[model samples]
Target: MSTHLCSPQHVLVLNCGSSSLKFAILDATTSDEVISGLAERLGSDTPSIKYKYNGEKQLIELAKGQAHDAAIAELVKLVNELGLADNLIAVGHRVVHGGEHFTESVLIDDNVLTAIEKTAALAPLHNPANLLGIRTAQQAFSTLPQIAVFDTAFHQTMPNIAYLYALPYSLYKEHGVRRYGFHGTSHYYVAGEAAKLLGKEREQTNVISAHLGNGCSVCAIKDGKSVDTSMGLTPLEGLVMGTRSGSIDPGLFTFLTQQLNYSVQEIDDLLNKQSGLLGISELSNDCRTIEEAAVEGHPQANLALDIFCYRLAKQIAAFLVPVQRLDALIFTGGIGENSDIIRDKVITQLGFLGLECDEAANLAARFGKEGLISKGQAHAKAFVIPTNEEWVIANDAARIAKEG
Candidate 1:
């Protein structure tokens, strides 16, 4: 193959979870994905990687108990065997908690890695895996630049009033305790996309973006900057999630311990792993399952669906206070993009905002397609746009690599 000045360069974006590694190689010039895959069920009896290339999907099995480092090594070997390693420019990692240290994506170095590690306490399940990916990638591709894009970076723009908890100021001053929202890359990307759909410049766009996955967050964006967000300190503080009980009486923890003889760890496990939709419906954590049961006249399922929509609408209303004006409301992520029933229920409660959902349009927007789901002449509209965090990560890496 002949090399040319305009040859497409690729940036590999990695999102390392506790038990899985999701990756995508995207053409930096055109923002198109060349390949995407997931290596999951690691450190278990069965570990495997599913990769897609040239429109063909294949799976690679690994020995049991393989870890992230070994998973990434296999990926690197695959890239090299395909003769694509030479065109790889950089690797971008998704770091879940940057705290206050990173307001933007930065090329990683020793000090940056240390800062990320320091914030590990704020993100026990995420930061360590993130750092692992960073370290492993460094060893696999020592010559290329590695960038850290933070999940909390966009919400670092929030003012003190919005992020501060009502707890004593000394806790925040001494312990670094405050709201540090997650899913910022998704929020920021979809906000920009929302602006384009509204035919407005990013600087003039104001909106509320909801990312409703297993872990969910809602962001209030003013002129493209996050003014406020739902998740606080940790990801467990926001909307009712697949398993996470969103916001609850802070004293409930003590109540469980005192009255129920539950240990602190047990209470934590209850709220974070056993509550929310699953607890409410006594069925499944999945929204689809709950909606289906509700349609079949299950009382608990109906109650859970009502609570989810009501709580989500309340949070959206609270976020509107930060921006003082709204242009649109965007729904993204699994539940947001695919569930028209939940969207309609949430919007029906927000009638005071002069927003109306166009049911037919919402029905048309599924399987990762964008659609406008608002009635004509409404002051504020609702939209469903697919979130592209990997694209955001790759773009940031490319820009930082070019600057260097």
Candidate 2:
């Protein structure tokens, strides 16, 4: 028989990016963040670490060419100095891609480390950094269990038809090439929150989750499970993002190579880093900046915003086909939660779906607050919910720790 778990403890959540590391300490019982910080520009000439504790901010400068190991050491030191190390029962790491291996958060071990390494090829820029953090934490706090909470794990519930591509069978069978969506943590968390807001059981909720930041993707959740998502094999395949050219014609590669004399690598870089909103505006990839410029009658900026909102709305509408009903349209992430202009413009395009935007609510919801922006007989309500991936990670880790 399953018994009640022990009292909650603090969990340290680590999220490692290509050049940055974000760390947080949270109380599992109360869902309160005790402390948080970010270490940026690692391996660059000017590296800095900034953290907040007890409402005070602190900064630390690093020597030239310092890397992940050094940054982690500093984090360990900070946690100890702040007297948070002993209460940290478990450490949770956010791993970007689990491929098809991990379906949920698991305790980190040698086998898990090996599997994460094997999946590195699928996420060149992320997995390695994540692995580094896992290893460093294992060494720094050897006694505590290190857990891996995957960003792709939540979407593993997707059906075969939704994930399989039209590529050759052998490529998929032999190379493990298929659509594995990103931002599953954010999607899952917000979906749960949306379900709560509606006072419905999670198994009965259906919502379209849009995560719009520098990297954007939309997820279709039917009955609390991800049925389909915009992002595919790589993060670069979804909605047009800050610099990513989402869902471009494959023919563009051949055309660029043949006519523009572009190499495969060069074309790859162009699409992955040079396109999207920045490509459209030829100014900035930031939505706020683009919005300001558009208000000033900048043609390209207006065009950029239009294309982003229109494409996003179309994708949201398309996702509706997979669900039994639409309960809510959730907006999370940087722009999704904060930018009323972007939210209003996207909802304007989604008028056909009966989503009406309440201007006051839309404007009121900013900087990590929740707001229901739809009104009066709308088929589905629209919301702005701030995502807390670190909280999810901490809770997952705490559960695993208690189970053991």
lDDT leader: 1
Which lDDT tens digits does candidate 2 get at residues 168-221? 989889988999999999999999999999999989999999999999999999
Instruction: List the candidate 1 regions with Cα displacement exceeding 4 Å.
Output: 1-6
RMSD of each: 1.7, 3.4
TM-score of 2: 0.97
Q: Give the per-residue Cα lDDT of candidate 1 at 318.
A: 94
Q: Report the C-alpha lDDT of model 1 over 39-132, residue by residue, as the tens digit.
A: 9998999999999987799899999899899999999999888777888899999999999999999999999999999999999999999999
Q: Whole-model Cα lDDT per candidate?
A: 0.93, 0.91
How does each model score on TM-score? Answer: 0.97, 0.97
For model 1, what is the error of residue 198's alpha carbon versus the real structure, in angstroms, after optimal superposition?
1.3
Residue 90 error for model 1, in Å? 0.2
